[model samples]
Target chain A: MGMKLDEALVRARRALDKPAEFGPDLNVSEFAVVTGGNELALSRGRDRLSLVGVDLSDENRAGSYYQVDESVVGISAKMPGLTVLPFEHAIEEGIIENYVWELVPPDLDKYTALNAIYGRRGYVVVAERKRKIREPVQACLFMSSPGGIQVPHNVIIAEEGSELSVYTGCTIMPEVVGLHVGVTEIYVKHGAKVNFVMIHAWNEDAHVRPRTAVLVEEGGTYVEHYINMAPVASLQARPRVTLAGREAKAHLSSVIVAKGRSLMDFGGLIRLEGEETRGEIVSRVIAKDFARTTSRLRLEANGIGCRGHTECNGLMLSKRAQILTIPELLSSVSDAELTHEAAVGKLKEEEIYYLTARGIKRKEAISMLVRGFMNVRIEGLPSKLRRQIDLAIAMAAAGL
Target chain B: MRMTALYVRNLFVRSSGEKMILKNVSLELYSGERVLLLGPNGSGKSSLIQTIMGNPKYEVVSGEIYLNSERITDLPTEDRVSRGLGVIFQMSPVIRGISLRDLLVKVSKRSGVSLEDVRAVADELNATHLLDRSLNQGFSGGEMKKAELLLLFAQNPKIALIDEIDSGVDVDSLNSVGKVFQRLFSDENRTLLIVTHTGHIARYVGVNTAYVMINGRIVCKGDPKRILETIFKEGFNKCLECVGVGDEAR
Candidate 1:
């Protein structure tokens, strides 16, 4: 059940002064809530949607949800098997009350606290039982109001034996100073599968903190891919996924292009909590041009005959850039198998030489290597979405 | 007389750490000619090939290299490769992110070799399985050599400097690779300088001239049949003894 507004308000005030465990705390009071920007994020904003990977005139998507600063601007569902709605609307319909603040705590940190206080704009997507939706449900969170503050909470549910995919793109305008705090909760029922891809393209003067958590039941699978190739002043996020039933699986992969004096801390954690369950986390980071990033991946095995692994890889592209990777594996039972591997270094000189020797120019060869390094092939992804991810990888490799 | 395809004059080479590797070496390969460089182990034959290919790991301390009678001792590896100087290295490095198909796609554009031809060559060499794999990761010895040959075939360079093409190869793989070498040498306009210590490649391709290098110096240059027969009969010790007494033949 959804908590009342006064109780959430109390928790928000308690953690209002709480500093995050990573990155410097931005003064939340500097950014005031501005409501009436009246900007349709779809097309009039000079192709900002495409930059974050939303086609302006795409017919392949099953549905779309668009938000502009604290207001729901567009919601369209082309198929009858899916339900897409704004957060306040979903709450009013009593369709997603038990899912809000279910996976993520309201007062975990200042960002989540702020989201609990003022988060009524994000979308909620639900796939009915045994309904297979091939096309991805696309969502866009656009921030165009300068010096504005946005707090949104998102919820997604996949019923039993259903298959669904969602692509969420978060972006800001060319020259906007904003603060974005988004909290997301996802649930995958028995025998259902969900593939989620979230891409962020914020400008240089933005502060972004996104909190997300996922849960999978018996025989269900959940795959999540997060990519952020643009610049941000301060970015911090560490999403966790839990396999809560037998034979459940989860795959979490993230690619970050840290550049332009940016401070970024990225992470993913997978917990195997059921018998015969499996989980994996992979992170790829490319640091360049005076940027600093620390990536962490953790896997925990707490069930009988359970298995988990983590791979944390980072590449440094600049002499002044820095990257640090930490991989942790925890096993509680005697039969629980957990392993991890971490590597952080620059591109190999021999690999570059090999390509150049084949008559490819040095610049083109380096670009290819960087693009390959950032790619993480998600299994069973639709070809249409795979091409968009490839474009995103190419754009990220070209430069931020 | 045919035009000289590759020429090395008074060449002195050093490793990246400033230690000398090849000393005062001189050689030549004319267009449409196949020359075999037979040397003992650690005789600096591979170093010479590396120097000729403009690998920065091996620097030219002193001398000149001319490709197609044009001086190119000061050019970068990228420039030299674009000018049709191909090679099958003694050891192929592992390029983690690049696939054989990816490499061959670019080479096909430059060398004008169609993908159909590449597929045919790969099928003959049993290398079609490696087209989608990373350049050389987890490849067996035979597979590595075959991959190198596949790339050089797509390259179709003006001059091919093959190093140890016969080493660490099985009889079955050698048979397939020998077929590729024969096809490559069938072009009368192309040039070749094959380096091998075992002289196993002699069974496949004919050698017009042969040289035996010892202690970083070419001590003998003569007819291929005679030199190989002598080396096989009496062993390399005799050559070393003759050179120690300063009675080596050239």
Candidate 2:
């Protein structure tokens, strides 16, 4: 089922040329270079790499939407595994396997690798990864080259009754033309469960565009969470999932932190097509230091006894920081219940005063409040992941 | 006679380049003495208490304060509290997520005091019922004052600076608070510096001497019953005659 890997490389390079026109030197990491080929291999000292790309359609067919930049390095599945496919791969393979594709920015692009380029820019896996992977597969895409881009295509399939978790994050090295645009897709089988988390933090002057889509089978459950921590830039992405099977459940949560001239256009979409399906969408954003953010949520319920809920909360730290939230719900079945809510405001003075009265200084008071706000989500994550996330948040807050 | 348990000399408090709120206000506390500070609104009684507690918001222009022969004017709030000093703020300190019993336990442990003593004080102050509740969270004004009493009982500091325990308190709360103070100030080594405007607290909680403050200066000092009666009958006008306005509070 593995076609000529070189053709995919050629097609991806053409897409890379679009962003390359502004400045060829920007192309630090070349996507066409093959670092290592196997089920998975760690590459070091790469300028450009593309992680994954989806056909942007169900039938793995290829067209203009199939093109992506040099960040995602193209490679063949040397090992016989999941025979995975990008959204486009699904179209071409004629396998209606559940997956999603997105055109996210460079910062989000780094999310598909390990430590955002501690070694190489990104990674790719081609294995028959069916529902057996209990641990959430985490891929961190890190870019070391300045003004370079990475496109990663990630695919996960839960075989019948198999459960899995997937976490992906993107970080950029300093002065690097940090641009990462990525797409991811998750497929849950009958009675299977999948939890997906995406943490996005980009350097200043970086752009992020990420899209994700998931499909849940009969009695399957899916939980998706996206965290955006970017610096003085823009993040445009939409993660959507469909509960298409009977008794399927879907929960989506998102957090976005924008500071210093940063602009974020973030949102999520959920569809409940199965009977007795349940769906929840929660989003939070904090904008500070002359930053602007917009959050939107859309949910659809079509089956009897289906339920959907959406909430968007925004906290503006500085006067110049701006936020806009939109929460929308759609229900076709009368038996389904759908609700939506949205709010935007600054830190509460009473909460700050409360901490200060505890003998905490004013600055320390503010920091503790801010830490408390972020800790809500931090506490929910696993211990090791929470530590790394906290370090990154602290660095970003300090304007590093 | 016990030496001065607390002594403040030439104390001046200022904020934002302004004149001292407490202009050269000075006073002395002796062991086993409960001194009540009386003054009109903004007359510097609370300011005096805050300065002695080392609240960072108020800057002392020139002043020196001592507790049991050791100067504490330059100490931080926690350090002052560490040095056998306990204060109950005028406004109830609102706390959250910390249960009353847990906070009492933490304060006792940090103070290097016995938990059994804290428990006994909690029982005496009727705070045992509140042990399950969060510290000062959702507490009424009266309840919050009682919480302060509970803390003071558990702390058992050598010097206690109590601010407005009678203000905004019901009769029952006042009685309980007074009893708590009696238990706390039972030892001869303990000194009480209480700030209040009402004479009723003096009636309920006996004090050795009363200081009448007018516009930041301690204008008069006499027996608690006499000064409180004078202030009630004549207001601050009588205080002006006792100390010439020409001189600062000291």
Q: What share of the true interface contacts does candidate 1 keep?
A: 0.52
Off by over 4 Å in 2: A1-136, A144-149, A218-220, A245-249, A272-278, A301-311, A331-343, A377-381, A398-400, B1-250
lDDT of each: 0.85, 0.63
Residues A1-400 of candidate 2 have per-residue lDDT tens digits of 1232333333444454233211112233533222222212213322111211111121221111111233333322222233433444454554532222222222333233211222222332222434244333445555555455555555566666765555555555444555565555567778877666666656676766655667788898887766666573556766778888999988877767787787778888888899998888887787888887878788888989998888777777888878888788887888899988777777666545433333344575566555445533322344444444555456444441
Q: Per-prediction TM-score of chain B?
A: 0.94, 0.89
Alpha-carbon shift of residue B250 in model 2 (angstroms)? 19
Q: What does the lDDT read for residue A272 in candidate 1?
A: 92
Kindly state the number of residue pairs that clash in model 1: 0
- Report how far residue A311 has shifted in candidate 2, in Å: 4.3
